[model samples]
Target chain A: AQSVTQLDSHVSVSEGTPVLLRCNYSSSYSPSLFWYVQHPNKGLQLLLKYTSAATLVKGINGFEAEFKKSETSFHLTKPSAHMSDAAEYFCVVSALNYGGATNKLIFGTGTLLAVQP
Target chain B: EPEVTQTPSHQVTQMGQEVILRCVPISNHLYFYWYRQILGQKVEFLVSFYNNEISEKSEIFDDQFSVERPDGSNFTLKIRSTKLEDSAMYFCASRGQFFQETQYFGPGTRLLVL
Candidate 1:
């Protein structure tokens, strides 16, 4: 069984300050990791994904995350916070062993990002 | 860029009444999926469809749930008998055949069972 854990339920950061959202995963095989953002009453948008090609992955809206195999963590980060960045962030993990199919995504509970102006 | 689209931004129905949620996946996508998120809960997978048939389904998807690709472009999820607990925001997603491809999600339909 594979699962993702987001350490923080809520994170607050001041404008122009750095932001971080922590996530960890447990998988038996190599995993595909993803970060998605959802605004109120809106659909989820993929910020970035890691398919084993690179450890440091950059995403939209000046966001990025590092996949650390040793730590079993994929934490999202941003250099500066913006009001628009306030939203719910989800960390997802997908393994290739999903009965030979790949559309399944195991999601974390979610972390709410609050940007203060 | 192509994306998935779902109809009925919000639907309110009585218990025991049937409801059908509709979605139009990306034109060239081959896989379709349905997921739901209860208030203040993690998103849970319901089912996955391919080649006009169900390829996979989660434990939550039982006899009461069914999926169909009525036309070439439309995919639908039908709940035979709705319950108060069935109220949630349902999301439709689609993915192409690329290895480890990302799934695109629709705006989602909020179903309120009264």
Candidate 2:
């Protein structure tokens, strides 16, 4: 049973300030982790994914996440928060299907980020 | 920059009515998937399709649900009957043939069962 837990349901930050959205996972084996963002009325957009590669993964829109094996964490971070950064973020874990050919993503509850101008 | 596309950005239907949500995945992609998010709930996987057949499905994908790749371009999810609980945003995604290929998502169709 693989799952992800988002530490915060909502986070507020001022523009130009740093942002952090925490996530932790429980998996029996090495996991593929991902971060996705959803704007209001929009589709889920991929941020970044960790597939046994470098621990630090950079994504679009100036966001990044570090996969910490010891802590079982993959928290998203941004150097500065912009109004456009406001969105709901989800931490996802890929559960491999038969033959490891395809994966079904297990998602977290989500963390709503509010950027204040 | 090929992207997945979905039709009927929004749909409203009466209870017990059947509805089909359509998607056109990236032309060269081999894997297609359907997921749904009820209001305030996490997105959930419904089914995954490959080689024109269902490769995997979640518990939420009951007998009333079916998926098909009718032609070279269209992949559809048909729900036999609509219930109030069915109202949610449905997303279609596709991944390339290579291993560990990233899945690209389309703008979802928001379904409302009245």
Give TM-scores for every candidate, taking all chains together and pairing residue i with residue i: 0.98, 0.98
Error of 1 at B8 (Å): 0.5
* Per-model DockQ against the true two-chain complex: 0.75, 0.76
Error of 2 at A35 (Å): 0.5
Q: What is the lDDT of residue A50 in candidate 1?
A: 94
True contacts kept of 1: 0.63
Q: Write the per-residue lDDT of candidate 2 for residues A31-107, one digit (tens) a residue.
A: 99999999998888999999999999999999999999999999999999999999999999988765657788889
Poorest 10 consecutive residues of model 2 chain A by lDDT?
A: A96-105
Fnat of all models, as shown? 0.63, 0.68
Task: Give the candidate number with the greatest DockQ.
Answer: 2
Candidate 2, clashing residue pairs?
A: none
Give lDDT tens digits, candidate 1, residues A19-114. Answer: 999999998887899999999889999999999999999999999999999999999999999999999999998755445475588889999999
Q: Candidate 2 chain B: minimum summed lDDT over ten consecutive residues — where?
A: B96-105
Alpha carbon lDDT at B9, candidate 2: 99
The reply for model 1, stretches above 4 Å from the true place, is none
Assess the local accuracy of residue A16 in candidate 1 as a C-alpha lDDT between 0 and 100: 94
